[model samples]
Target: MTATDPRLLPFSAVLSSLENEGAYAVMAAAAAVESATGKPVIHLEIGQPAFPTPAPVADAAIAAIAAGKTKYSSPRGVAPLRAAIASLANRHRGLAVTPQHVVVGSGAKPGLFLATLALVRGPHDHLLIPDPGFPTYRAMVAVANGTAVPVPLRPDMRSFDMPALEAAVTHRTRLVVLNSPGNPTGGVVPLEHLRRIAQLAVEHDFWVVSDEIYSQLCYEDTYTSIASPPGMAVRTVVVDGFSKSYCMTGWRLGWAIMPPPLAERVELLLVHSVGCTATFTQEAGIAALAGGGEVEMLRREYRKRRDIVVKGLNAIPGVRCDRPQGAFCAFADVRSFGRSSKEIADVLLQDGLVAVLPGTDFGEQGEGFIRLSYVSEEEEQREGLRRIAATLGRLRPVKAVA
Candidate 1:
């Protein structure tokens, strides 16, 4: 056989079904556009916060390194950090968790993967994920060799379509992933919806993986967790991280809170896979948990950015945007222009030099919309809005007068 022969090796068939998050792909394409044209691309594609890590958080990490706390501690996490996480959970979500229930990982993705792997046995298992949701939930289900059932969002894009979600659940359903203040759309699941979901999980005897990375970024008066409802704390895995809230994306610190039994299993998974998250990073997480003021400031700034982007998008001739309740994205409706979301996104990138994601990148339900992250400065966001309006104006649809 030749060195480059197709039959040289066998790869897992599951690899063929896996799809990546669209943000990275858009980022790469934007980079190429910037390379080809001398103009800098206005970035609205990526979800990362533009803010720097707070000084106290950075100082904590530095102090830990100076104290030589660099070795692997416990797969469950260091004692102090775990305790801090549990305390934070209790304060925010009304949970009575303890350090024993916390398991730290490199990022929320690892905990999400481990939770799916633990619950999903094989292709017979079904996992319900939000349509117009974070892509990682589906990707993790694929990794676990399970069937992913997409639950479409309601027309308002504020929460799941309960009728659709109710119809999607079956005896084979093993898990459901929930993301409040969710990605792409910035929709916060209402408390009543969470209550209904909690009831379903109890009735169906399935697990819930609640991704709350954006919990601190909520613009609403309060944030609710599905785990807060009765009987949910035992079945729910609360996956959160310091990346989005603390601007510690590069630090790679995230954690999951679950029942002690499952926490043990997930810790074992951590031990055999990545071993443990960096000790110093966990120390930084402790500081982040204590530094509440910095987080509130970040949240306030994000709210301002959200207002600016939503208003600007709404002013465009064919574009309409709802004010996002939380998170830092503007999901703009572009169906009036008579084009697919991908086509609109491409025109925005190529013609306007603005980078954004097509809504279909989230799921089929996102067909007529596009997602733009408002994580950049207010000035940059306005500039991106200008480009989108100018580019899309050329394709504006004509009105038929009666």
Candidate 2:
């Protein structure tokens, strides 16, 4: 018999057409180039913080390991860690989150995936997500075999389209995913918009999954949780983690807050999937909650970097970047240059030695934009901007008229 074709592997259909997160793909490309050329590549592609893990958080995890606390934990998470997450949410977001409402997991991502799987019950179920939003939102819904409908953000780039959202909701709409201090754009959804969304969810009787991982990094506006609204706590699932605020990326721990029954369902999913988040990592999360000072220092530094990157991008010719109200990214519009974002990103990487994610990879509406993460060191951030400006500056001299 002839040799079988290698392409005929038994992988799921989702794997065949997966839309990967562009940031990580760019970061990996940058790494390969840096390694091969033995030159440092300025990384503005991903949101991995430049700071080391907070000392207190690291120490707590070490102590737990030294004390032989490495065994498997409850699939729902450790008791103290769940309580800590609940308390922090209540204190910070004015939500009535109790331990009963908390479900800890390996990271916010897993909880998000589990929530989507648990909520999106059938192939006919429809899930609403923001266009040009986090790539994982739609991916998870697809993995759950649900229809993913993207609601585009307003042209102003500050808020979502309320009328579009109202029109999108129906009995088939099972879940709506929201990201505040959003990824890539760093635009926070205002309280009024959130209130309207809450009202819609109440009327349509659909669940809202709010991904508030960047809640602590808001630069201008106060952070608000949709669950805090009256009659909304029971209908919202909050996904948060220690990766951003405490710079505990390697720790791999995060949690969810929702109604007790929903939390239990998520916990059951965790039980059947991965056993639980590592026990010691949960200890580290406990320390992070206790050490508020570390998070505050990080917030202050990210705010400064945010200002620098926004200002630098705006100063460049053919580029106009708005100051992000929250998070550590600056999404710059480069449509004026009449180039796809990927082409610009390639030029920056090859000529300028700077890496950024092309926005079009996020969704259709993300075309003509590129997302730069300002989570690098201050000097590196400045140098990356300089290189970006210098390279783009050369293009303005002969740019084609639109």
The model with the greatest lDDT is 1
Candidate 1 on 48-97: residue-level lDDT in tens? 78899999999999999999999978888999999999999999999999
> What TM-score does each of the candidates earn?
0.97, 0.96
- Candidate 1, 3: how far from true, in Å? 10
Tens-digit lDDT track of model 2 for 1-402: 335766766679977657668877898899988988889999999889999998788999999999999998899989998888888998999987789999998888987999888888787899999888899998898899999999888765656788888889988999999999888789999889999999888888999999999999888798899898888998899999988988988778888888999888888899999988889998998988988997788888988889888888878877888788888888888887778889989989988899998888778888988999989899999999999989887666245322
Q: How many residue pairs in model 1 have overlapping backbones?
A: 0
TM-score for predicted model 2 compared with the true structure = 0.96
Clash pairs detected, candidate 2? none
- Candidate 1 TM-score to native: 0.97
* Pairs in clash, predicted candidate 1: none
- Which residue segments of model 2 deviate by more than 4 Å? 1-8, 397-402
